[model samples]
Target: MTRAQHPAGDPGEVARAFEEMPAVLWAFAGPQHRVVAANRAARASVGDREGIVGRPIREVVPEMAGQQIFEMIDEVYATGHPVSHADRRVLVDRDGDGHLEEDFYTYTFLPTRGPDGAVTGMVVHIVETTRWVRQRQAVEARADDSERRYREARDVVLGLQRSLLPAGVPLLPRLRIAARYVVAGADAAAGGDWFDSVVLPDDRVALLVGDVVGHGAEAAGVMGQLRAVALQALVSGAGVLDSLRRLDTLAGCLPAAVGATVCLVVVDPRTGDLEYASRAHPAPLLLGPGGSARFLDGAPTGPLGADGKPARRHHDRLGPGELVVLYSDGLIERPGQALSAGQAELARVATAVLSEPVAPGSTLPALTADRLGALLVERFAWAGYRDDVTVLVAERQPEPPEPPALRLPAIPASLAAVRVAMRAWLGALGVPALPAQAVQHTLGEAAANAVEHAYRAGDPGEFTVAAGLDERGVLRLTVTDRGRWRPAPDDPQDRGRGLMLMRALADRVEVAAGELGTAVTIEHRLQRPAQVSAGAAPPEPAAEAREVPFRIEAGADGPRVLRVSGPVDLATAGELERAVRAAGRGGLLPVTLDLAGVTLLSSGGVRLLHRLDAGADPAGLRLRAPRGGAVHQVLALTGLEHLVT
Candidate 1:
């Protein structure tokens, strides 16, 4: 039943089936390529049905004249060969509106041969592909736009990341500090990473490295805010745990900083004492002078905005010539590698780089902190990183040579000798000129007190002066005498002035008296400016004394105003005292000292003011200094702010 009902070999039925097919079919006869037959689809494609048959191909579809379709049909008829095209574009007025529209087709022109094997006609087959082609083009356009947006966001985030980082690490006397930051690979977006070094008020160096959880501008902004908060806390002398607590609180307020991590280390370079705290950050690696390295993982806590877990401060000490390395997790994180393995590799690489022998004739005594940081970053990130990487190195410098002790006879001449010795010692210690002069003058007073009161009249005795800088950079000067101690008389004018002067000049002063005589101990924390390098030679003393620029101007019939525009330290304080005395004219005239222009108001300068104030009436001598100026600050610290007008 199936075979008989199929009508498989019926000529009329086969022709009907071919004409009803979905593909467009047609035939052209002779060299003119005159169309002889066309199916329903082919006739409809040209916007004609009855008029499309029994006509030349160009006449049937006038728009095909310049499209070479007729030439292909003629070639197939003449050569008995076939031509085919895939996705061929054709412009046709399919709706008969006199406007051509684009269309794509996969079509073939096959030669139809006669019984003699000579080509008699050509048959064409076509399939429209316009819908598929348009769909693909639309998808590609969306992809291109998305890629462009991604790149723009990445660029913006990278710029923010760089601007948020510190421009340079602080240069310190006891600590050599350096930092480096590296971005991720080119294909990856910029991640949030930052590093900073701040020299605290106590001369301790604070090093920090941190990472935020995500990428792009949000991550960068969160990183910048966190860094700012941490820096502010540290500069305010907040302890390690306290600073991290502040950072954690801020991170809790920021959704982007939820998983942020940071490691902070504050180190007293003079004592090699380091205290550190971390919030789910990697432990710092410490490299010793003996070529050994280990991670400081003593104190650890959950990441920022994590479950409540109290942060703790860890205590560790670095030896002279040793280094403490702080870095972001990127430095010790690699794909398919364990976190512990990455950290171990970091320690190994840091040790190798830092332990390498210094080049011959190198100006540095050993590997510098800057060079060490660079090497560590290069070694870990040479193959490229998927996240941002940062490294910070802090190295403790070697101890400076101690100054010699001084022993002099208890006489008036000994005071001068004590001043000379102390000046030389303080200069060798790289103390600034003003502070050095303050120390020298303070010691001179202590020595003069010993010479006058430590012994009975005409009893020869020797006094000893010893000075040493402790591990905390405190200069301790001890003036000892072997004679018996004599109690101060009841009168307040003569006996207690030297002791009061000593307390005012030094940061702390203590007088120990017993049968063994007296020992006056003075302690002052030596402050070194960041610009001065460790072990740098003291600058040559000025051969000629710098002249203080002094000019007296009458203040609108008020008083003679003496403007002093130079440092008022030990070397120049006597000259200033003399000028003030001359201006006073034996306490007969009123004088005002305008200290607004004074660059430095050392303790010697303060003493000169005290003496002048004691001799003249309080109304006769007045001081004028700008509020918040250096002179005003010093006077406030010395309890002499009342003198300023």
Candidate 2:
């Protein structure tokens, strides 16, 4: 460790140590900035120092000749003030490829002052920072990409929430409904808030408003499932409380830690009575005429999925022209406001709206609903709402008057009036085309019979007809006459066919005759095409099959036999189908469907026979020869004999 033994003790070794520094160091000795001495780092950046020394830096790295670095070096040379840059761009042949590559470096240029404080030459030092700069930029790019994905995910969740919400309010018979939905924030994902107006099995209107546990796609998806379950329960005849309990049970079966708050209000359109249940949800606001308002919050249960506790039901009488507001917490909940305060504010707004006089012109129920919903949203949830907001307003419409009955005098004009009234009523009830036509026909026949046979010219009796569709989807028509009965003609041809025609068109026909009056009742079961069961095979005739109107006989020796002894029409087509099917099932070939005993033949009967013949197995059906009877006349007019033969 003696000084003489140390490498620094020798000038040559010292010089070599200085030459091997990691930084790029060099000294320029002239105005042109000629390189006088350079370190190994500098030589490595610009190639061997043998020919580079004593050359201007521009000559060593030609790419740097016209760039700002030379100008900065010249400024330092002229002012004698040192200059430093943290990330100076420099080009050099670091890879010894002859062509220079661009890179970043921390560099400093200083004036080497002489004895009289005058600048003599320039000294330079640099450290490459290209790798660090590139690494920092890569990290920043990754952060930006991650933020973009987060926003995209939020947008997708928002879209999902919107898709699952109800498109519009239901058009219940006695309700004017309006609703609105708002999301929490622009950047935040959509939360689980929803509202619906569904028609329950009892024909009551169920108004629902709910909020699920959280935000984003998961909450929105859970909201959809819970809404469906609640509606299904109501549609299946569950009461308000029962429906909420059912939803709570369903929520329990879902993934753990999920929960929701719901409010269900079932309103009976007939009585203006509302049965409501709440699952830790806020109360509904009742706004009446002249700015009267109150909150229906008596019933409260644990939030849905909270250990499945049974819920309580509350009842309130909602009169005509009164408004009921149901909403999620998001509607009233805002910063610096308690839930009770929000509820109070909502009541105030609802009352204000109610106080406004209805415009001179009529306002549509849907438009009123929309206007109220918009007002409530604008009042309480305009800005900075931290949760999804949903508001539903329902106004009880006045009970509609009972449909009028037709009390027509016993005259030909009365028959047409009955038909017109029946058709109008059927159309209002949304009766399908097929069932409506049948009703019109049967009702017309009953009225016409009363006009033609129930009274004489001097008696001038009156007749009344009434029709309606019951909750079971059955159409009922009642026709009554206040006249003396007339005896039937002894000959079949002379007797009228009014009674037979009515029986043919209706599913059931009931006739009662007395001195007071005669009343006929006709009933038809109305079924949507999709609801008719494919397996509703025709029933076999009763034990008194011989007394039945239609009979079938199967045989291989000749065509099968289907004999009709009564009028063949809508009411009796089913009997013919059953007989035909029974005969066909017996596997008899070349079946004969005989219509020899058909006293009357209607379009319904002809239609059934045509379908059977057209779809029968090849050469499967043949008809017995007709001899100018009603059945033969119908076949000849309709050209149906070709299929049978």
Candidate 3:
């Protein structure tokens, strides 16, 4: 029943009912806030409020003396107003440990009015909320720790996988080579699919592509062993059949029950002579310069480890200007699809890519081999695919030579030309998208610095941009200018970000300054995009999430408040975005985000908020101002404070 409906008959009964209330309730008299009357809960909390009557609150709870509680109580009494605080921290003597224990509570101080409308005393009410707050903190801590460990493990696996893969196909005379590996979308670790090229005794290169039965660390290990053994056998003067037989026997002796399908093709670079053996792998696609494509689907043995079958050798000669494609089944196998259909699709795409005209003045092998492999991976590797794909393109070239380096005048406009040339160069080298972008960004920044800062505007300075792939497939670009070096000004508003951007993007950035000129060199190790989705934009490091440093304080009958408190830089912006999206997911209308606690907010964080605001109903989401701190300064500078409610 409502308290208004239950009439109080006597003062004694009313007092008894007040004493039985659950929460801590008490009254104090005078501005000094001396205890006057307290309920049972208050008495139990302070170990006898009756004995503490007529005493100041400090005398009973000394821990509250130097804290804000005293000032809060005084403010209520003087202004005849009420104050409410949720999640208020206080020190309590619950365990009598000779020291106060930290606790959280919801506290309220209401002014008690006298007959003349003057405040004579105050009523205090408290509800403990320590258990809930502590539990939430513990959960968040555990989640952060778990995520850190998982990321570490994934990085280790990816590093191991990259180390095992070929750095780049060895530059065999008269051979144009390109290869790609697309890891499964769901596999954070490495998979079994791999490609390798090893030079044999008579200037012939053995191209191999293989796929183990399963994926992950174990399968990658087996794939590594098989690849190593097969390459060693060929180096030991074993023929194609002998190498396959040896690999089959080796697979049988492995401790784990592992099986694999492989295609081994040995090609004489001088004559386009090829002797290939397929162990139930996808038939190799041969593409001619005239746009005709054919798959060599000869009678082949079962996958390796099958006891009764010996792999049969098939002899083929790649005519001059004809390209041979070796691949794993992951390239063609799809759920519930016929293998023939996939094969047909592959032949059609390969033919189309081959038919495209080579860039004017570009060699046939340089233009076609790189373009074909990139085109296939770009077209086929869709998101959520379960298999790992490996494609290797080997073609006979006429004295395979490197692309020419670029040189340009030292001017701002020259940066764009340099960028285009570098991109084309990196692409011809078959560098994956991630490293390609890194090289392009780093090179562009260095070139811009040279054009704008290294040379005087009217000095007629010329900058040269030279790029080359090293023996181990590392792309190194050097931007050199003839003018002296000029250090960037020490101004946050204008200077020094370019160098930071360059260092962040490239594997290594080295700068040398002499009287003649300044040179900036950038190095990036070229490898297949590891732990990344193919055909999709590689996950930008700027968008990666660090620990989420924020909290949500909520109430049953009011707007939910999310308080974010940390430097929201590029790495942490994603976490802040996620926090806001999660809060909105509850359909909790009129959710208020309090940025008062935020120490910093970057442009990325600001953009994230704007995007959310653009998608949100204006009345459903409100942003509180960042109250004169670094966050406030940032919002002011970016003109983002207008988004605040």
Candidate 4:
């Protein structure tokens, strides 16, 4: 086409337009690839404009020598074709400095044909894209960092939740317990859900489940504090309402604990009586032995730190072989579902799982409770829970067997037999060695009173020792003799020392005199460890005889330390007094009596110590006993704690 036909399409017009355009444009000629024309953008990109036109492309941009741009332009010119690249990295010394700077660009190389239709030269168009590329990279880096921080926070919250939960449930004679905890979905922050069980001093079992508001570390921390406070109150024999009241007051102090929810239930394993209180928590579910399930939602209260109204206590009973379940709201909450529907689904799933016949030889409620809890968690949380899920199951077993009874004559010799028999009985009942020793010492004192005071001389009266472990787990021992009950003497030196010892050791002690005889009954509650299973067989007693030869080794040196070993009781009290007298050497030097090896320190030994202290100087006699040992505990209980060194 001629320039006269379309003035705008003239070569000069096109060249002028290219010179003023913002894009980099250049025209190359011949095989040497000389620069035929250069635009303003082109000169600016090279950071120099002097002597650029009519120069070879290599002379104008010397930094591009090793780059593939020369070859690409040559290929386009020879083949009469076009080539394009996007975001290509290029290094250039734009400021004429020896150092090279990196940048990104998109460029196209187009061939220009001559009149004979042969490729004559190439036209190149280039655009810089460095700013856009860097922006995109910065955004991606920020996203990656945010994701890493979120994962770390979730891990910390999860760790806190697990650490705050109960390590293991208590094992009681007539009760079985098990618990399970499940975290939220993989991408979600951890929610606070926890469960706990404790055996109260009155032999009642307390079950607790709680959920703190919100998610992450704050929620977990609040849940931990609430759990600790609730446990302390309940284990200390606080009533259900009283414990919840304490938690309510505590919630007022903790900002994060506001609106937290908890359900506390105390059950009497012996009678299947349950007393529970709620703080905006879900009701407990009772699973009957006949596969029937029901929710104990009769009583409900507002959340903690809400209205000042006192929480109401609810009462229920668990039948034999029936199990009660306490759980966090997460166990029954489902997305896009009503609360009632979720609860019904939970009841259905639990009943279905528990309806199946129990495995043979798994009659122990512990195994059954464990299986139930695991199955419940599996059924409800298998699809990835949105909140933390927790479930606790407890079932009452059959009544335990009665403890054995013992009968012995009212004499000093019967003291040793009483100790041996009581030791065997208490050990069989899964009682710890320390408590067992305490019980033996208390019963020995009761029996010794019968031998020394209950019957007249030459009366030949007999005393019967009857022992039983009541449903409350209190060890009860009754010593009866067909004799008179002696009253305490007015003189401090001649007072009823054995009676004082019995009262100090046992939880409750009673002495009664009637037409038939005088009876001394002692009661002490047992605190068994979690490792001891319900109705575990009594461990076999060691074959070694109980009679450790009573001996006193008086060191003939400074401080006069006397090492005493063996059973110190009514039969050996005289020997002990005589040995101390002989070792005292006129009571001039201080004497330390080490009772670490004394297996049994009865009231007779305590009375002897009192007499020795009363007659000698205040600092003349010192008693040495191992800390926390049976003998040490005896001395502490008998009001002789100050005498122990």
Per-prediction TM-score to the true structure, in the order listed? 0.41, 0.40, 0.43, 0.46
Per lDDT, the best of the predicted structures is 4
* Tens digits of per-residue lDDT for model 2, 1-645: 765688567767777876988998989976788989888988887656358887887787664542346756776888888987675445455555544455668888989988898888899998988888668645543344347567546566455655787755554435656666766666677678877877677777888999998887778878898888877888788888778877888888876324688888888776889989888889888877666889985968788878667888889988887878888887777666588977776776666444433332212111344556654654443234677778777777675324449898887655545555655555444344445555665676677667666887567689988766553345678989988667534333434444565665678999888998899999886542211001111111111112223444444354355554644554566777877777677445445766655544555566666677767775776675344333554566565757544
Candidate 4 TM-score over all chains jointly: 0.46
Deviation (Å) of 208 in candidate 3: 2.4
Q: State model 4's lDDT.
A: 0.74
Task: Report the lDDT tens digits of candidate 4 across residue range 533-590.
Answer: 1111112122223556778886555437888898898899998887787677767666
What is the Cα-based TM-score of model 2?
Answer: 0.40
Number of clashes recorded per candidate: 0, 4, 0, 0
Candidate number with the higher lDDT (1 or 3):
1
lDDT of 3 by residue, 90-198 (tens): 5445444444455667878998888999999999998878788678655533354347567546666555666778766664336667777776663455688877887
Please list all clashing residue pairs in model 3, or write none if there are none: none
Off by over 4 Å in 4: 1-173, 176-206, 211-401, 486-492, 526-560, 585-590, 615-619, 627-630, 633-639
The per-model lDDT (C-alpha) reads 0.70, 0.66, 0.68, 0.74
Q: Per the 3 Å backbone cut-off, how many clashing residue pairs does candidate 3 have?
A: 0
- How close to the true structure is residue 611 of candidate 4, measured as C-alpha lDDT? 81
